[model samples]
Target: MSLSFDVFWSFRSPYSYLVTKRLVRLVEEWDVTAVIRPVRPLAVRTPDHFVRMDPLWRPYLFLDTKRTADYLGLPFARPRPDPIIQDPQTNVIAAEQPYIQNLTHLGIAACRMGRGLAYIDHVGSMLWDGTVVGWDQGDHLARAAAAAGLDHDRLQAMVDDDRDGCEAELQANEAALRAAGHWGVPTFVFEGEPFFGQDHLDVLLWRLRRHGTARRSSGEAVDG
Candidate 1:
């Protein structure tokens, strides 16, 4: 038997990057598949969200993400050219986002091509790992695409040709996400059950075990 789930993910969430690794491991060790649903960050989707957020929310999130990254040995840092250009003083997300649209489109294209998780691992690592400055410059994206077993030029061409189609699909993904009773990224839905957040991986695994998610024939769990 095989198992699978839908992952509602965003390009800007640190938690999404953290969960991608674990999701990859699950699929590699078990007879499972991850249906990727790429979504926009809340800051972009609902611009007023930040203004209404509690003052402590941003700071607490920063502190928690750093702590978690350290524990997992994953290098963490803010993107050099942030996907969303926000006003630091007011926490207002800019109306014109130059980066996220392109990145999200490419991610969607990868998912359409059936290698979404691989693409997420490759690209998400570069952004979250904190070492690549000007990540969108030079061959950074091209290299990441290649690493994920996707053709950089080919994906880019698809994105350029059908931007509207891609956006429509992404909009549908958001609808499905909300219908699942969660708006956050990294939400995994299995058998109509929603498992949200990185901390819930163990819980998700427990549920999978109960339902008999098939493991590798060799029966060893390896972190990829």
Candidate 2:
């Protein structure tokens, strides 16, 4: 009866990065299973939708995300290559794939290799710590993936080529995230309730603790 949660994450969203950082610790300290389910950010999924948003909303998001990060004791900085958007041609040439494909697969691979937490820690720290500008540059993600005992070259090749295997896994993650009732990044699902944003981690943790305790009191077995 171990409590498990699915984190629908997106690398492009600063909130997602913050959520990853905190969730890594919660998973370890609480001895709960975290299913890292990555998906494309809303910007990519519906660029026109974002473009049509009230202009004030865009700037407000940046300010709000930074303020939230400060409150959480996490680093906050705008990533280099700011918008993270690609033109149709460049996007297609880059295989037009979501960054989540690589990240989620790496998480899954790490779990398979018994290094899931390690993988989350290294990669999430680098991405969210606000140290690097262009976090997607060469060797950044690759090095983190390597730390998880994965073959960085093979993973990159699969991601770059947009291999069907990789695409399929990402598609599954997207489906799962959507089914969990959120199309946004940093959404954490517990008992079928979607808690959106890093700001909600505290609530998510409370839920996890309550669930774990209730199960334990009921004489239910817990799994690691």
Best candidate, TM-score: 1
lDDT of 2 by residue, 1-224 (tens): 46687777766678777666566656556656777665666766665666466767767987898888888888777666443445533232233544544566655555545555556666766776778667667788777777756666765554556556655766787788788887888888887899987779989878877776232333322211
For residue 155, what is the lDDT in candidate 2?
A: 57
lDDT of 1 at 1: 67
In the range 1-224, model 1's lDDT, one tens digit per residue, is: 66777888888999999888878888778876778888988899889999999999999999999999898888899877887789998998888886998888999999988888889888998888888899989998899999999998999999999999999988998888888888887898888788999888878888888888778886443321
What's the CA error at residue 127 for candidate 2, in Å? 3.1
Q: Which stretch of 10 consecutive residues in model 1 shows the poorest summed lDDT?
A: 215-224
Instruction: Enumerate residue pairs that collide in model 2.
Output: none
Give Cα distance to truth, residue 16, candidate 1, Å. Answer: 0.5
Per-model TM against the reference:
0.95, 0.77
